[model samples]
Target chain A: MNVNQVVQSIREKVAEGISEVYFVACGGSLVDMYPSKYFLDSEAKKLVAGLYTANEFVHALPKRLGAQSVVIVCSHGGNTPESVAAAQTAKEHGAHTIGLTHNKEAALLNYSDYSFLYEWGDDSNVKNNPMAIILDLAVQLLHVVEGYAHVEAFQKGLESINGIINQGKKQVAPRARVFADKYRNEELYYILTSGASYGHAYGFAICSLMEMQWLNAAAIHSGEYFHGPFEVTDKETPFILMMNEGRTRALDERAQTFLNQYAEKVEVIDAKELGIGTIADEVVEFFNPVLFYSIICVYREALAEVRNHPLETRRYMGKVAY
Target chain B: MNVNQVVQSIREKVAEGISEVYFVACGGSLVDMYPSKYFLDSEAKKLVAGLYTANEFVHALPKRLGAQSVVIVCSHGGNTPESVAAAQTAKEHGAHTIGLTHNKEAALLNYSDYSFLYEWGDDSNVKNNPMAIILDLAVQLLHVVEGYAHVEAFQKGLESINGIINQGKKQVAPRARVFADKYRNEELYYILTSGASYGHAYGFAICSLMEMQWLNAAAIHSGEYFHGPFEVTDKETPFILMMNEGRTRALDERAQTFLNQYAEKVEVIDAKELGIGTIADEVVEFFNPVLFYSIICVYREALAEVRNHPLETRRYMGKVAY
Candidate 1:
């Protein structure tokens, strides 16, 4: 199946599997999976946890699957050994399964009761990961728990974000240029965000900092920064705070004012308002990382280029065996 | 009044007024308060969360607390303007207040209907924050939870930790001599630990790196590291792993072994078991940051001295608000 069709299919599967979920993914796939899960979890009535990696799964054995459990596995390449083993272990313990994958080596399709392919093996621009679309489809599917109107609205939000991402490519790189110059001698950054967008900020900060800038970075909820990271904020600290276009306006206003109090150098990325036609904040929540953070990747890329560092290839994060 | 008696007084005053709790505190006081609330939440009890800081209390508004809420404020100095303001805000909202402070103008005490203080005041240190004990006392009084044995053990553990910190001073500087030389050029670090100790690691790493080393740092649960940070692990990466005795030995073992696989250099500090008459790991959890991370500070100090850079100071994390 082509990526678009597979993306549509995963959403249907997630909607079907909403009653019982056991997410098992690692590295970049796990990081990419959070946007969908964040939406599912905020609205979900069932149990959910994002496991760290496949190797760590053996430790959680006594909490094994029953007839109700459904394991969902995501791996970009399907070559990582432990993720494969983890899926196998879940099956051995008697759980139904679904696999989302692009890699041929993935044993996930073999082990899973149902599977969706995110790659049609077409000549695609490697930069735009279709897997993100598939991931959102899963979130869109499970959002049916809240009912169909919500799910349909959520899909349209994803499409709106896809449009934004396309438009952002021309403008993002240059806006991020100043940051590239200043952070040359800098080695760490902190990002503090909130609610559904929190995971998006969290994912982008870590992944972009690691892959694009080769810099160590951290992210926390805006409230949590006050709890701990606030004490350390000083003139030299680099901080980025995300602001929502709607829904979180008060929180956004407070966080921006509060964060600016401590950080010497601060950057605020405010989400552009969509004029609220049909894509409400809730439906569009999963796309914040795409809409808000891809612009950040431009800065990150600019920073790397100025430093003469290639977009550091991530050989470790998505090499999944499952 | 004694800590328990003061707690009883607060509960009585609060019973006549508010029923819900929203705790606000910092430093050792917050640390002690967290455990009971954590345990209570784990036990599936319904109680509003302790915001952990006055700064946070004003911003997050944490679930449900209003006219009939109880604001529990703990601060040794009581003078921190924000803490004082938080208690005042809650009182303005018609809340009952409980102050656990070492001094009256320590701000919190002035606004409370009831207050708790230790017989010892200025003499208290991180190892003996009167505010911590009093907060613990308040939790027990309010919850009617009995764990006198655990209290006795923890106190004894604290006492032993004091002695170990004293003894450790002699050994740490010498070992630190090696690292201070190497880490001088590094500007970032990532500390990973496990279990409840993970929070401690997160706190201490932030405090120390910002306070003494001047290196920007982040901390995560050791197992949780593989979930996100492991993909970026490499030679020349500044990695510090915590190996204190706690709930999981497997995590520490795995993290250390994996550090060998990916890290250019790894620093391991074996903490002394806390309390007398206990095995090393048994007591290790009590005051592990002091035990294991003292070497890190020493290393930083050695670097500052050798490199002629000023030692990083506790500009904001220490006793004074300035």
Candidate 2:
């Protein structure tokens, strides 16, 4: 089913008395939940939202998770143990569990009250990707339940996201190649961003750079950069700053101005220059992650090619068991 | 004022109508706010809580901030600009503002509806530290507003914390020295923990290690270890694992087991062994940050002694303008 159809079905089921929405997942999937959670937190009048790692959510279950709650759990492959367990726990509490995954037959589906299958390998259906779908759900839910006014603009923005992402990929290619070449031998890189773009930067740092490329990387919030992490800035240090056109853009720009002066290498990926400027300013921030995901994928691909390491290459992730 | 008295004042002022709580701060102070926010998130049935860096809090003000909201802003020295702005914004929104600081005369106080001064140089008053004070406020508010049952036990535990910390300091000295010696020359270190202890680990990595010592470090959540970070672990990797005896202890243990096998230098600081076990099991996790804070201060001091790099020696923090 399309994302709107999925949201329509969800709206028809638990739209009356829902008070809480939980975005629970793990790893990259957990990061993917951030934008939607951020959206709800910023816009929802009566709905309280939470974003949690599935394991922590299971261990420290919120006291309010009952029939009034709608818990959304996401796993890329639909088989993350913690995600499955979180769904089951939410189910036991009588909260409606919405499971999102790329796989058709997922364990999460069995425990979920509703399941949405997102496109995995299909580039043509960029809007059907897990992050995009979850975000669409959040937008639709907010609009349906609380009369969020920007729903139409959000959907229109999403419709143009594929084109925006394609343009972003092309626009970022030259810089991505340059960054890969320049930082090819560097042992550590810090990925910094704020607001909605933070999650994508986190995914890029951990999943793409550290896990896939075997490079030391950390994702730092731009707003939190001045607090303590800024002390690490020096002539030898390198940084990747993800800039988004959003309410927290000033935070990113502040960090950027500092990084340009202190850090020798600062690779910036600005959403405004990546076609996000064409989007309605009100709803553009919500799409920052989608655009960022595409741009960073280009970066990781370039880095992988330059480093002669495939993105799937792993040493201990699946080969050895703890 | 004494913590309970401060909480009493807070309870009397806005306790009747509070529906949302925002914990706003920066750097180590931001980490300090995590425990209370976590406590509220786990225990409070009606109050929605948010933990944010002060800048983000100011920039993306929650739409729910109003007369029914309580904003807790903390700045150790009481002059963090973003924190002051957050307090001001909260006041503008007609939210009840509670400012926590060590300084008696602070800008934050001007914007706050109520203010609590914590002890900075007074080691005898550990219970009046910012984290302890905010946590006490949370506990009392929970009890007064929602009738949280463990308030007395939490207070008793707070009274015993000073002695527990002193004992923990002596107990951890030998291991701290060993860890400092083993990783004295290391260029990069990763601090890992889960649940309530994660914030303390984050403080140790960014504030104590990176900001103070000018070392490269990243704090990884133990629950997130297997996700992408574990791939960076190998025989040469050095790690400082902060383990707390909490609901998420299993997550920390799982990461510790993997780190012990794959990483050469795994420095484990167990709260259970650090006198946290003496506290009531029901309230132990809430105090993990307090225990971990003292233990890591020992680790950082030992590191500074071994490296002959004074913790106050900063190249850019306050010496140069960003």
Q: What is the C-alpha RMSD of each candidate to the true structure, in Å?
A: 7.4, 1.7
Off by over 4 Å in 2: A1-16, B1-16
Best by lDDT: 2
The residue-by-residue lDDT of candidate 1 on B1-322, one tens digit each, is 6556755655565544434466676544454455434322222122333434455455434333555566777766777665787788778777777777667556577688667664442223434454335435434544543222244555555556546655655666676777777776876777776543454565555555644545567775665565556666789887777675644446677778878877887776555332222524433343454344444555556767765656545444454332
- lDDT tens digits, residues B1-322, model 2? 6656755666667745567878999998999888898898888888788888999888888787888777889998888899999999999998888898888888989998778877775265678788888888787767766688888789899999888888998999998898899889998889998887778878887899889988888888888878888899888888988888878888889988898788888888888877788889888888888888977888899999999999888887778776
**DockQ, candidate 1, vs. native dimer:** 0.15
Worst 10 residues of 1 chain A by lDDT: A119-128
DockQ of each: 0.15, 0.76
Clashing pairs for model 2 are none
The whole-model C-alpha lDDT of candidate 1 against the native structure comes to 0.57
